[model samples]
Target: MDVKLPEGLEAFLAAAGWGDAVIEPLAGDASFRRYFRLRLGEQSAMLMDAPPPTEDPAPFLRAAKWLDANGLRAPRILAEDAPRGLVLLEDFGEVRVREYLDQWPADEAEVYRAAIDALVELRRLPPGPFLDYSLAEYQREAKLFVDWYCSARGLDVDAASYSAAWEEVLSPMLPRQRPGVVVLRDYHAENIMLLGSLGDQGLLDFQDALVGHPAYDLVSLLQDARRDVAPELEAQMLDYYLSKTGAGADFTADYARLGAQRNAKIVGIFVRLWKRDGKPRYLDYIPRVWALLERDLAHPALAPVARWFDANVPAGLREAGGGSWQP
Candidate 1:
């Protein structure tokens, strides 16, 4: 099998000292970036092919540095060719936690414990070099539910008021008054690489990290939209996080709000990926996400958003437009 190289990417790999390595292209996410696994003898590394105009490697570079400094296992930057949007990175290897779970079902609790521990460790770092996950940003993101998803479904309602409702509810919950910890926006099982039997995890797809509510990443982990985390485990993990962090009583409410917020954004993003970006596989995850969204809305803290749903969206439409519900 042959893999086409992005323009100038081959030259960069050579200059970066991997000219003779075997390059195996890996499946990329819903972005313009591409990754190649380069193996030469016992030495292995990953090469990023993030093209210009559509993508930038700087955020990933900055994030990698910050994560490594904070004792997380982000891939080390072995070499860089920023002008051509290529970076040689230390390969963290395969075996995503989600994949690992397929064979080791009993390790579920311990694996989530490690992930939650990573989040706790991350919260200790001082915020720097990241966008504040302010109310405006949250509103902008949540509005995606109205923009792409609603339009795709042809569901016409008050999108403006929808945003207002979000602002009214979230302004107090995730108030823009202060700074926050760095949030790896897509922290989930797929993005977490299970490095060893010792329960270490490697972070990936963190170029979109931002300063946001500490609960945001936690919800991203436990209430993953792409995969179903057992409700029992989810509850235990939440308790574990709260116990270790000693957060106030508002912690549960915060988790529910951000969970709803993130899932709604993902609903829109999945639709956009299909209708605009021509990727339809994400639609299969909608039912999973909708289930998570419904659970989040059930929280009393989300009554305002729930009322909006009850009034605007019918029960059947709540799960409408979703593909096959996978377990």
Candidate 2:
């Protein structure tokens, strides 16, 4: 109710002939950024309020432009105040993949297939000048879990052992990987929108687009936050991706490694979200993520890391904040 607009934002809207518009705050995630839906006549727009010193709209704008140029479905930027970290964008509506999936469970396969298709198409585009979403970056992100969540649960993680095992499992994977065009780091159900019947879903929150493996986005999608996509479906989708990309026989091992790596990182991320960010709703999903990690670890290719987790990591760590693990 007390949504704060940037300085001179009202004036800017007034001069742009949108003075009569009504703005309402929209639910936001953990980021410092805030969003508002603006209604003008029958048309609507979305405004991003990213306060400066902590949030910047430049990277998002640049990534959006690059995606648009590369034939992706990112929102078109209508206006901006980069210095103030504010951006006005075309509204993509409220039909997230989560909502659509809930409404039409019978269409899960078709809808998820469409999402996979979009990911493949996005991966086909040439890489842009975003940022390196490298193994080091992933390692850094994964460590956040131990620092926050593990510590919160009163678990003392052997940092050296964990890092050594992680590197032992993931290091060899880097060279074997065929670099892809670009990966939308969080290309999941929540970030994708069912725009309409245009056969195109809206891509949102892709500011972290990076140059990475083609399998990365697929892992993010099937291994999502809101729901537990079945392992069978996950395998089928991985095979579908492999076939479409012509990735050859070597891809199977690499895909499994990537899946394990992604699941591990997400487990840590979900923990950090609950422990540090005070978003405990994510805690209930940790067990499912850990189960996915365990399944991925079953691949013979991940023996070293799997052994470390199974041996050193306490069972209490997995059941730290349990809700349901079978999903």
Candidate 3:
């Protein structure tokens, strides 16, 4: 289905004297928003079309400013029409971390290290109201995986049991965290660009950045949904981060717990993308995530939730299969 451009988009471009540019549709996410790559002579820009009622572009604009101010590489907002929910941004090119790694696996460690470095730098930024990375918010977002995926699967999960187990694992872990800093909620391969000369990786789709756990972003990048980062590499990266931060010995255990939590939440999110958004492509990433979740469960840190899932989530539901439930 073709997406209708918001009213006055043509005028906006014309007023900016970009009317001669060629606009082509780019890939989009599950949200109602759409992206178009516009070419004007030697210059290029990304056009965001986020229809109102279902999508708003304010968060993206606000986050762009915040990231730019804090020494990150979010897209620069070239123009905006908030009432029409349209914005034009500088194009970051098409060299996502995933593509770069696929072409040059040898550079994975270096690329990932740079990505982590950017994340660490982001963590140094002071807190702000625009960034809400509190524990309650994290728990709420994590529960989305359960609500959308588990419920859709018709699994009989005892909410109180699940909640209690989550608290048992996460509550103590929370206070052990050092001072809060900005966290790119989805700092994965897909959202990073490997610009050749650009010292820092280009950050994209960070409208949901928050002030929370220092390890959360690291977990997201290393335990990515699309790529298979080796165990040795993952361990080395974790250690590298620890050395940089000078976190305590318990940091390893906390990292494992956070990884397990993040993987489980992603599993539900992938399933939800398929079941709710009619985007079944996300289902392909489920097995890898499940493996990560199970691996994290093996860690002594996640014993409670691991035990609960092993007993409750049913053996058949552990893997992806065809068939939809009426419920």
Candidate 4:
């Protein structure tokens, strides 16, 4: 029954004349950000409490402005308390693309197509000065698997070997990054809302946007760790996005390679969430990540990384996170 806000958040809302609004806590994602739905009669807005030192709201503010300017539905910013890391934002309603798909499974294609179109629109934005999501940076991410996951299992996988394998796998693909492609690092259903007149996607959690490979966001959608997008539909969506786009014909290989790298990093991240952050919810997603990793590794371009995993990672380790991952 304690609906009271914390860390001056209640005072912040009260100052905004929303002290009487009914605030309902919303389920948060894997990040440290917290959210609440503030309702004042029929009018409503979203409250983002990203208390700093642990979380920052500046990037969210910047990305939202740029995305909105570019015509993507990034939620209009209503108000902000920067020092406190609180912001009131335009609510994109309650229907997420994921929830919509659950309600009308028949509209799967239409829903996903809208999301793709939003991505196509966003791909045109001139990227900001965020950190480059470079191969070297990702190689460090892959080392998380060696540092935490392998260590947890009491295996001594050489970090140098792991980084070397990533290098071999990514060497052919790194320089191929599509210039100006502002990859919204997390573009999956959970963060995308189904809304607006064009029925297109509304984006969320893109404060970490970075300049990177074009296929990165697309792979994020199709190879979602949160939900299973049927393989056939995944292929269709991929084909749909590529048909009219100017990406090279061999972009499919690039997509698969990025997918492999992303998934590899995610598996390690999920493991770290368990071991370091003490958040075990992500542990359930590891098998799903492994399945995507398997699919990505299937690509000929991922041979070195695939071979590395096959040789260094034991069968028991592969099966540690229990879930059914099929081809």
Top lDDT model: 1
**Candidate 2: Cα lDDT at 85:** 82
lDDT (Cα atoms) of all candidates against the true structure = 0.85, 0.76, 0.78, 0.81
> Per-residue lDDT for 12 in model 3?
88
User: Could you give me the TM-score of model 4 versus the true structure?
Assistant: 0.92
lDDT of 1 by residue, 99-170 (tens): 888788888899989989889888887886898888878888998988987787677878777877787678
Model 2 lDDT per residue over 1-327, tens place: 447677778876776667789988987786888899999989999989887888988889999998888888899988888888888898999888888888888778878888888877876776788666677876776666566555655666677777777777777767644455677878888899888842578898888778877777887898775687987888788878877778767667766777777777777777677656767777677777777777778888888877776675677655553233221
**Ranking, lDDT, top scorer first:** 1, 4, 3, 2
Model 3 residue 25 lDDT score? 84
Q: Which stretches of candidate 4 lie over 4 Å from their true place?
A: 1-4, 196-198, 319-327
Residue 300 CA displacement from its true place in model 3, Å: 1.7
* Candidate 1 segments exceeding 4 Å error: 175-177, 319-327
Task: List model 4 lDDT by residue over 73-186, tens digit each.
Answer: 899998899889999999888888787778789988888888888777766666655667787787887787777667766776667777887888777776777465778889
Better of 1 and 3 by lDDT: 1
The positional error of residue 272 in candidate 4, measured at the CA in angstroms, is 1.9
TM-score of each: 0.95, 0.92, 0.92, 0.92
- Index of the highest-TM-score prediction: 1
